[model samples]
Target: MKISAVRGVKDILPEEVWKWQFIESASRRIMENFGFSEIRIPVFEYTELFARSIGQGTDIVEKEMYTFQDSKGESLSLRPEGTAGVVRACIDHHRLQPDSVSKLYYTGPMFRHERPQKGRYRQFYQIGAEVFGTDNPWVDAEILSMLHLLFEQLGISGTVLQINSLGCTECRPVYRKALQKFLRNEQASLCTDCRRRTAGNPLRVLDCKRPDCKEATQSAPSVLASLCRDCMAHFEMVKGTLDLMGVPYEVNERLVRGLDYYTRTTFEILTDQLGSQNAVAAGGRYDGLVEQLGGRPTPAIGFALGMERLAALLPEETNHSRAKPLYLAPLGDAAMERMPLLLHQLRARGIPVDTDYLGKSLKSQMRQADRIGAAYVGILGEDELNDGVILLRNMETKAQTKVPLEGFVDQIAETLAGEGA
Candidate 1:
């Protein structure tokens, strides 16, 4: 058998890399502007970290994790999501110390074992932002605004932000039991996963992606309807703040995000651009998680965006940047001798440059430059070399100019700068 990439993982080819670069670059700009410090955590952690934080019954812990026992007999797992690892790092470093709050952002590959599709992959990248040590609804509103601003900056519109309050510890069990009772009647129609989750993780039944499970839970009890007074008040404050900021949203009763950690105020920003798996970003409040993971009693909220899903939704031809290199075609012994120095100088001065290093014929060199889409070509022959000048030709306009070698570097820099390069 021919060797290839593993079944679900993929190589991001050179041509497709610019789209990813655009997303990562934009994420850093927007995230730093909002004051979220970048956080880098280990790819693999103790398996218990996920089981304890993400919940053992959750599909992520139960099925998707790429887990293994090391030779030391300790079990570890490649993180399936960013939040659990981020929280673990925070607790370990005492980030919750002395009235301190940590706002963190991370972008990298997360591992999972899944059947890959259009926007889902076994190893995928997610851009996540988390705010720790605050329970204020205004913080939630600000996070939502920043997330909205990101999509807007990327030129993706018509994304609907659907918000819901999943109630708190005080009232969640009540809704859970009611949902279990309701789903029990439709048990036969439920998918295998939903039926299995019905007893212990009934709330997750609402998050199931299967068509049968979705239909069965259509009339199931909504946590929004069962929100306690405090939960209701908190939810109201979040909505009011968003309204005051002029952020448009709808109260989606069915928008229970696919996580066990989320509490009061869950949301998923969706678009029809990607079909069934349309959620580009989703997250909510988890007031009890910090303490659950051994940190001090802290409240937190944040979101993770599916970069693959977002990349798929981006416009095929808009604002994609390319490096406009000046390709050099040196045709004589002296011109070739001078080529390397010119290459170094141009690079040092921040001008993008390349040259035919394989000693191809003049015709072949010109063809190579055009094939590589060079914006300008620098042609040096015996006559130009003797005169200490170069024939600089614009590939687009086919205009050539005699540029002196002693003054060439500065002249080309000024010319390219003038052309808005």
Candidate 2:
């Protein structure tokens, strides 16, 4: 009987793992360059944490979260997103004190119980970053600028940057009331889930993707039109800063994120290549979440990029070609026995090298070397051994040379360096 992986889960084989590595390395480098320290959070947390933070009516909380009871009957859930866990960590660690700012980044898997599609998965990875302790619109601008730099470094262009203001508590209730009225009137046109959400979280109805829902909400009251003076000013400054920094963006009047905590600035980087679920990255400001989760009042903002989508969008040439490795073909048992030390010496010096340990034929080993993309092949047989030398062949040029085996490790190392291997 054969056992297979669970449905909706995937194994990232070595050939495809390089793309993930490239994305992670590039993300880490860019985040560090912007002074964001890395932070790791637990894969699962108390279910209440998400319910309290992501809004109980949201799809992520109501339908997508993988919730279960622990041995003690306490509820626990695999995280559906990164920001809530990050905020919980900050609060638990007392890192959200007055006048102190915390900038952090994380990369890992998140779980959801939903139909798996091209880019959306029940278990998927995300690269996210968060900034806490300030509501300055300049920070929002800086965050967007950092994201812009990341996409540019990844060589991904033609992505549209859409921005919107979700207003603030002071004035959002008015917009919420107006939006609820509008949605209630269009109930026949809304989806079942959206109809249930109309009274509790009307803003999310505007973010719906269904044709009927989108059409019904197209003329829905604009949250931007109802922004309080302070919220309007903050949104303006964010745009002004972006203009000063040359970050192009579009103002979407109905671009509310699918989270309850978002307020003021919300944005997403979209590309048409990924179908309807086209957002590669999205986030916004959540100035009230820190306090809502039991911490003293604090301001925070962050964004998460879908790892699967980002890897899919990565250019074909980026990180696709690796430095060719050195292949050691030891033809006899005696030659095989001597390879470990030589292999270690070369590898320890940062040279990529490998050798056959299966005691295969010279021709078979050479074929293996070619299959593995080796740039140079070192062949040692009876003739070469008796001559006290090793035959080194440049796989690319088919050039062969004999080198004394007495100090072969150092000699081969020098020759490889000289040949720019």
Candidate 3:
């Protein structure tokens, strides 16, 4: 039987995982700097959580989510996104206590059941951060500023930040009617999904990526045009703050993101490197979600970076560029006996070290080290055994040192530290 991984799923093999680790490390550093703590939630949650927070009209709930019945007949779903679970966690644990704010970030795999394409996958990875308990426009600006810093640190360039105002409860209905009217006139040109969204979520039609749909709605009414005074002021302040911080952006009036929870301020980080899936990150204010989900009214904004999309734009220098392990190759039987002990002690002290398990010859072992780009190689053989020493060779410089076995690990640690290994 030729069994294989399911369609639209991918395995992040060892050779390719350095990029993922590097991204995760960068995310942690940036998130912590912004006073955001890490938060992890279950991969699956009650189906209604997303259905409520994401709104029943959106595509995520209507089609993409992985929903199923548990053994006890409870309806559950693999989370299609990160925010719903994070907010639910806050409410459940009372993290959003009275007069308290929570800033959290999370990175993990998200499941969806949609068609996979370039820079788009059914099972994709995302790193997202959320700030709860503040409705200030500066909060939105701060998040955008942090996002800019993240991209700068990551070496991603030429990405565009597009901003918009989705209005609020008071003014959105008016825009909805305007958009619904326009969509009706252009109904024959919309794609099937946009046609369906017209009746359920007319605003989502603005987010449609179909060429015909975009052309049809080229002159469609703008959400910014319908922004109420409050939303207009909020959007202006957000842009003003971004300008003050020297963060660059464009007012993309047509940028209605794919989610239903956004309001007031919405923005997306986009790039032309990826063909159709141009948005690498997108987020906005969701002022009513917490209260709607049974918590006190709170305001929040966040953005999630798409790993696959970002990977497409990242330089090759980052892939498999992690500092390599110290490869220990035993030359003879005595060296073999001592191999396990030295390996264990080195690993115990948090050094990455590996040894030959196949009993390969010195030449073959060195080849393996070269294959893995080991920073150094440690050799234990007859001469070293008699003298209570081991030979360490710098793989890159081809420099060898005979160090006493009494403090072999310490000596190697010092050498590696010196080399920034």
Please report the TM-score between candidate 1 and the true structure: 0.93
Q: Which stretches of candidate 2 lie over 4 Å from their true place?
A: 188-193, 210-215, 419-421
Choose 1 or 3, whichever is better by lDDT.
3
lDDT of 1 by residue, 1-421 (tens): 8999998888889888877889889989999999999999999999999998888877889999999999999999999999999999998987877466779999899999988877888999999999998888998898999988988888888799999998889998888888889989999999887788789878778878789888877888778889899998999999999999998899987677667888898888999878677889989999888889888888999899988888887888758867778999999787899998999998889999899877788899889889888889999989998888999999999999999999888998999899886
True lDDT of residue 18, candidate 3: 70
RMSD of 3: 2.5
- Candidate 1: list runs displaced more than 4 Å: 185-193, 207-219
The TM-scores, one per candidate, come to: 0.93, 0.95, 0.91
What is the alpha-carbon lDDT for the whole of candidate 2?
0.91
Off by over 4 Å in 3: 185-196, 208-218, 349-351, 386-388, 396-401, 404-407, 410-421
Give the Cα-based TM-score of candidate 2 against the true structure. Answer: 0.95
Please give, for residues 1-421, the per-residue lDDT of candidate 2 as tens digits: 8999877889889989988998888889999999899999999999999999999878899999999999999999999999999999999999988998889999999999989888988899999999999999999999999999999988888899999998888998888888888888899999998998787777778878799899888888788889999999999999999999999999988687888899889999999999877999999999999999999999999999998998889888885677789899998888888798888888888888999989999899999999999988999888888898989999989999998888778877787789775
Worst 10 residues of 2 by lDDT: 412-421
Query: Which residue pairs in candidate 1 collide?
Result: none
Clashes (backbone N, CA, C under 3 Å), per candidate, total 0, 0, 0
